[model samples]
Target: MPAVTVPDLTVLPRVSAPGVAAASRPVVSITSAPSGTEGEGFPVKRAFAGVDLSVLDPFIHLDEMGEVDYAPGEPKGTPWHPHRGFETVTYIIDGIFDHQDSYGGGGSITDGDTQWMTAGSGLLHIEAPPEHLVVSGGLFHGFQLWVNLPRVDKMKAPSYQDLRSRDVALATSADGGTLLRVIAGDVAGLQGPGSTHTPMAMLHATLAPGAELDLPWRPDFNALVYVMAGDGFVGPQQAPISAGHLAVLGAGDALRISAAQRQQQRYATGLEVLVLGGQPIREPIAWAGPFVMNTRDEVVQAFEDFQAGRLGQPLPHAEVGDPVG
Candidate 1:
């Protein structure tokens, strides 16, 4: 949960409170993420499970990687895989992950670090725990989100961005009861470091017990809130939400979340949540396995290209694991 922190939240820039005319978004739906296994058997929570694609336009998939503390030699990660027509955004809240791609893009990211890889056109990549981390064993927690690219940018040259925790825009609520780490897009005039292909905003927030956060949001971008730890209420209706839960919000200019007065000892710090939203693409989606495209033919072509070795090959120096799909 130590993605980013400050000695005193009051010293950070404060997010202005919404005006009286601002409309508060209502909770449209709340769903609990189902636990599952991914990559080389690492446990994950399918955060977008059971949610309609139309409601999640521009966002294809989301996996909440383990909050588990692993013993020596128990850590695991994804094998080399091919992707096309989308981007993968991996955020590490704790522990370390090493990433390498075929197009000469690779790096090791740790606590609060982020790796943004655009798989436009297609490329091969792998993600695994660093050797030291795997040998020593430790706590590993994070999230991987798949963002869909519009048809125009689907075949654009691939790119990578390594965003460190120190580069994130830090902000606090007016009362200084909540801390926000903006990773992408604009929040109350504060711009995040990560640049996105689509218009979107992503942030991680920690609210003190019993504190309330009324956040201003873009009326055009769809809104979603996922609780990473502790319990809280979302939207203006005060719907109860807890860890592993995702809340989809309706149209509005603002969002309201309130943390419970008491929390379990494990989460005494506050309620941890990831808030994200993007302008809906509103186009037909054709997704399968690791590729996301706008038509069935495009998805088929992606698979064919990957199988024919057109995507790219693994680095000669790296160990190859089982294929993702």
Candidate 2:
């Protein structure tokens, strides 16, 4: 219950690839999540928009958590979209999620729920949720991290933070088989109540089978580890990995995970890992889908301020079209 004593993953300093680049240290990249191919029904693989790592420099993107099996009615989710700059946590973990936006913010998250949002200067969201009372089961798993908006706060406006599941902050691992859930920053000692504008950190582990955990890296940020369904041993080069894979570690100082006693329950004890990165803002991004401004005229002035409506505001329980697995 009291653990945040972090600081040990040290190894940093040693750049010289293209020659020098290390503001505070955080360079670790990894991208791997392929399967959903044959027709895309995703019998097993499903990365709607997952796998996309970006080392430190202020944590650009991390999306490495997937699952969506809503077919009882059709229409899945993500509708009234439009963001500006960055910030969109959205961790769900099992099923259900309603979400509304434009600044009014809405609700419904169910399964362990977590909906961070912080679009900055523009908004226009929607997540929808209904149908799929569990027939095909394993509805809309989760993971939707996409941060990057520190260049002067990118716009400073849009915001939200509906973290539930008992206000977060849990940390167990003696033989109870790992738990740790400080979903924002800080680490073991625990301190994740959502209130990040950048300078990030997030941990949401779970072991169970043969369990054995260490995790505590912040040699200035930029970290990685996304396995999610089983196979163990990470960091300290125990390597190994499994379920979809993604370790990516280097400028280290702390990290030591375990679980293989024949992998305990034969792997798959829950294992929904994701320990994002931060400390990187080499600016000049200016993306174009779901907005990510920097230029291109601020994405054409954010679609002309949502077509002159001035970025509509008034969310929270404003259900219109629901269905999110």
Candidate 3:
């Protein structure tokens, strides 16, 4: 990706939301995505809780991302769940994530790890609790993104991309305080580790308090940001954000973010943001729980393949789980 020269910051206009005051200078818009039934109880009810569904084109769902100070005993996570016709991208900023799948795929993802899995043609999987996280805690958080599939590949074979922290390409700012790592696609002369089946870009960025960044936009795709930690400002809206918040950006050349942290503020230590975008596919969708496909026939085909023990045939490492006991 060619580096787009950073334009000089001048006359920055600040837009305002209801609660956020628009300070006509460089500011960030921060809004809390409401949580419903999914985050009812547990150490952090909203830990796994997120904004339910995104009723938009090219975007089907968005999770505000989540975090929980692991405790002695808590509901580790979701049991065996199923997904089809779409892709799930998991990015871990800190802590550990244990995952297993009926496709014979299972492993532990550590800090700064990204797992991009495509549940094409149907697949059953479970993300077991990270027992170690229960004791140690230091920025244990991440996001799970669901990208809809185009009709052509809705029934494509399932696949996975396990990206280690080191595998991603990272670039340090000129001042050396800000770090940008492209987890997928390309940015700043760097490319992400995981190979994407779709045209997508996912990045993990950390800005030291007081640092600022201006990111270029992809004209062909819709862009958005999810705040992982810190209290900062982002975009032309200049929204003030807290941790675990999601901010969708409008179409433009590039977006801007500020890492203005105050001494007295708690959780104000710069900002952690996930920038993502992808070519939107306006295709027919058939979704049911863990299954998603272009047509009902495709969904039925996937189910029949799994029931007849044929789905696992393609994945040599797939471990067939108990028959929905």
Top of the candidates by TM-score: 1
Of 1 and 3, the candidate ahead on lDDT is 1
Better candidate number, 1 or 3, judged by TM-score: 1
Q: Relative to the unseen true structure, what is the C-alpha lDDT of residue 226 in candidate 2, on a scale of 0 to 100?
A: 75
Tens digit of lDDT per residue, candidate 3, span 220-299? Answer: 66666766678677776667765667666655556677776562255544677777777777677776555667788877
Error of 1 at 134 (Å): 1.0
lDDT of 1 by residue, 187-292 (tens): 8887999999999999999999999999899999999999999988998889999999999999999999989999988889989999999999888888888888
Q: Candidate 2, overall lDDT?
A: 0.60
Cα RMSD for candidate 3? 8.2
Candidates sorted by TM-score, best first? 1, 3, 2
Give lDDT per model, in order: 0.89, 0.60, 0.61
In angstroms, how far off is 121's CA in candidate 3?
0.5
Which candidate has the top score in lDDT? 1
